[model samples]
Target: MDLNLESLGFTKEELQERVIARICTQLLDGVGYDEDDNEFTTASQFHRQMRTSIKEKIEATINAIAEREVLPNVASYIENLTLQETNRWGEKTGEKVTFIEYLTRRAEAYMQEKVNFDGKSKEENGNGYSWSGTQTRITHLVHQHLHYSIENAMKDAMKIANSAIATGIQETVKTKLAEISTTLKVGVTSK
Candidate 1:
């Protein structure tokens, strides 16, 4: 069935976004680690722990999407929406790509480019040698999910807002078309 997102209390954008966010959050949370006894837990240590946890979550989450049967369908849906948004934004969104592809590209880029350290790389930093770059890309993915979820929720809200609008538009068009058809029928009879 062709489901119009608006009819079901969601916009196509909103539903997609909600799904993205939930998936990302769950994935990121999957990467968390527990502290060992006698480890000095400072505010910095907690922040570091959370950051690493989030990164693990994002990595596992995106990686798992590739193995799912729905990946193709989900990718197609996201691709279409990206195109639509690009059109709305009045700029070419550039080469069409799937969500899985996008995730892979971003993850790779994050690992090579962003996940560097001043004194050492992420692996070394995580071992307690020095501070490393925040896995901002992972954070970004989570943020993207949040935006999507909120949009989905908003779209759901809009379903009620446009209830009368949709009904009025449908009825008005139907009446006008019927009147024209009757007029044509009468004209034919006269001839």
Candidate 2:
């Protein structure tokens, strides 16, 4: 079912579209995908690719919903989501914060603002961390990308990118389709 933002106090449609487009685009860019690839050249061919993406996103979203919305015991490490938590020693105050909470705040910050397309932050973009026209969140994205290498003792980042993009597409499509379904069912009743 389509989630109703109106019920949640969001009244703008274009903003919603922009949010969707932005997130989807970010997810697409995160995993090293190119929307202009010639492999999906024709309209129908492109649509088929989109369908595949939608299916993958659906499965991811369903899995997420089931795990998050139903079962609370499972860990909240979303495959498509990039979470970054950190702990640092203070110079003098000696205060500390947990890494998990820090990462959650980062994710929250991302959701509250528009991510630049350069893939790097305003601080790191100019330092060559990423190229132009790439989405922001490069740090977390790259961290996740590199995790597989560290976890499995590999040296490649492409595999992680591919998996992230695949999962992101799957989750995004599923969430959007569910929202649409809810909207379509507003007045319908089973007889």
Candidate 3:
């Protein structure tokens, strides 16, 4: 079934997030870690120096996934829209070519096109729009998923850290101390 993102009270962007956390959690699943401590307790730390490299890898992965898996499907969907619109306009079959391959080529041409404004007329001007840099915009759009993924991963890590801290406090620190004021979320529900 064709799902309209806008009609679902959200964009692909809203769903784009949590990808990192979801992937990380899935990847971390079945990982050989300490059995005594929960997943949240024993956390792995990343070095700050590896930030750029890791981000670049994540971006590359995201782009690869988008281009290979997502783009074709999106293109096909757009082709349907294009065909429907063309049929609605009742134009000649060859006039409007938006069938995947042709559409992609046309889009790439537009994307790479550059304009020469220092011209007298359309005949003299070069064929490029000033705002036709699709690389940055497209990359930004696709790369956004990675950015959100990293953020979500960080958030997930933070939650895990907090959980570990609370559990540690309750079990280890709280036990040693006769009285404790820490509000552990352990089995505690808001009233």
Return the top candidate by TM-score. 3
Local accuracy of candidate 1 as per-residue lDDT tens digits, 35-137: 5423232345555677698779989888787657566687567765532125676886678666666777777866454443242345555764555665554
Clashing pairs in 1: 9-156, 14-152, 17-148, 21-145, 27-57, 28-57
RMSD to the true structure for each prediction, in A, is 35.7, 40.0, 36.4
- Candidate 3: Cα lDDT at 118: 28
| Window of ten residues with lowest summed lDDT in model 1 | 32-41
lDDT of 2 by residue, 133-162 (tens): 334365546656777568675535668888
lDDT of 3 at 168: 88
The reply for model 1, stretches above 4 Å from the true place, is 1-145, 157-165, 185-191
Better of 1 and 2 by lDDT: 1
TM-score of candidate 1 versus the correct structure, residues matched by position: 0.22
Candidate 3 clashing pairs, residues 3+ apart or interchain: 114-128
The TM-scores, one per candidate, come to 0.22, 0.17, 0.29
Off by over 4 Å in 3: 1-101, 109-135, 178-191
- Ranking of predictions according to TM-score: 3, 1, 2
Candidate 3 TM-score over all chains jointly: 0.29
